[model samples]
Target: MEATLSLTDKSGVADVRRRAIHMAQALGLSEKLQADAALIVTEAATNIIKYAGQGEITLKSFLEGASQGLEIIALDRGPGITNLASARTDGYSTGGSLGAGLGTIARHSALFDIYSVPGNGTALLARIADSRDGALNGFQIGAKSTPKPGQAVCGDAWGVRQIGTHLWIALLDGLGHGPLAAEAANRAVSIFLLAELSDKPADVLRRVHQGIKTTRGAVMAVALFDTDKRMMSFAGVGNIVGIVSSGSETEHLISTDGTVGYNMRTVRPSDVAWSKGSVFIATTDGLSTRWNLNRHPGLTDRHPSLIANVLYRDFARDADDATIIVVKAT
Candidate 1:
């Protein structure tokens, strides 16, 4: 389940603390774990107010088989992290106190990753696993691109995992915009990373559907590229788009039906074929359906970051969260 909290003042800290405690109670987190999560959330929220002026936070739970945990995201469009190395130091602070924000967050959570730029904003992600049996899986992430002026991200998320000889790529677009949308998108990536490798795309999507039941559901698409068989299998729900490109042609992957998390009964899985000289791109609805496979030729030849940038620049509408995930076979 997922819950979103806005942190604009001191009370926002309390609100987040209370929500964390309640979620911990409901999830049966040990007392120590609950308290640790609460303290970390408070520090994160306080940093948002002190550094960003105002911000939003999201808390989500991920449960698969016997493994379970919580993921927290703190986001703001305020001044970005000035000196990441200094900020992460134990005694460095822009506000003149002990500079333990990043350190404390890292110490308390099982995993932490931060993304920031001087003029842009900052995104802080933390995940706490319930048991030691769980292992973390990193996404087959490509490169990061520069966002054009006047462009805002639409909270599209994607990850790649290599299981045996097969590689899995998944994309998700969180509902709505801004911080809540970012939270949902981030949580989907965390879920995909922590999920068992053996789970099928349909089962994995179903788990994500059930995981986010408390918050706004998202549109999801998952694909598996099998090197041995030279085929690509995919499954999707909602409006997230997936495209497969070859040397001279491109093919679009279709969603089974329904969105992730809610109205899940109508959702199913769809599979396709794959081969070399092929690239896959998954994007949110912010992309105008006006541009099809024919117009965007040889896009996969560029870097994945470039692929996303070109699409965002050419077709993205400023109305909602826009995200694109690109995977290329080498």
Candidate 2:
């Protein structure tokens, strides 16, 4: 389960902490761990309120390898930190009091990352696992979805499944916005989760196409990684954009000009070498394909969620539902 809480006031911060503790308990985290998670949520939400004036806190349960945990993503459009290193030091306060917010969050998390520009904004990711040393053993996944303006639920949805070195991911954007479109997207996610793991990306997409035939249809993309073969098989229909990135190079993924479950064309899957440290990203057309990762240096190496949020923040076409999926080859 995932929950997003706006941080406009102290009450919002408290609500976020409440939800964070509930999520930690749901994940079977011990009392001490749950308290630590709650404190992290409190600190992050408070930082947003005290410094940014307005922002959001997102909480979700995640499982990567043997580590099952909770992830907290804090975002704000406020003035970005001018000195991140100085801010991380204990007792350094920009908003009064003892400034242990970011530092404490990092101390309690299994994995911690922060990316901020002096003027752009700041996005922080804190992952607290049920056990110590919780890391994604072979794959790293990140995804984000935002609803159309004035809507309660987003029409875009995505899912990821990683078993050992084999990882499969699907990004689906329903025909349009609102509940009906969300239904189509949700159905695609369900099918992707239950589909056979042995199937290739194209085959899995074929199954998704057939599974959502009753809905309004969607534009979809699928990526399959087989570490044993050191290759990635990719397939897509419609305008969902996929790209493979490594260091300073990027390869744009191609897609047929049709929608799944509606006038779909032949599924053509392409193969590409899966280099270590390579990152694959897929996004619905709600984000402009004109984005360039080179514009934001060192971002690709951050957590997948941060990468998705950063892109969504900068390039999202807010007139429609937006979604981004990022996977890093581990």
Each prediction's TM-score versus the true structure: 0.54, 0.89
| Model 2 lDDT, full chain set | 0.85
Q: Give the per-residue lDDT digits (tens) of candidate 1, residues 1-330.
A: 777677778778889989988887788888888887887787788788888888778787854224577767777767777788878877567674335668877887765667665655566766666663333231123322222224354466777677666888788777766556657766877787777877778778888887887767788888877777778788888887778877776677788667677776555665556665577787777777665644444445654534554565457675665667776665
Best by TM-score: 2
User: Once superposed on the true structure, which residue ranges of model 1 sit more than 4 Å away at CA?
Assistant: 64-66, 96-99, 132-222, 227-239, 242-281, 286-330
lDDT of 1 at 283: 75
lDDT of 2 at 13: 77
Clashes of each: 3, 0
Candidate 2 structure quality by residue, lDDT tens digits, 72-127: 99998888888988888877787863366578778888888999977777899988
How does each model score on lDDT? 0.69, 0.85
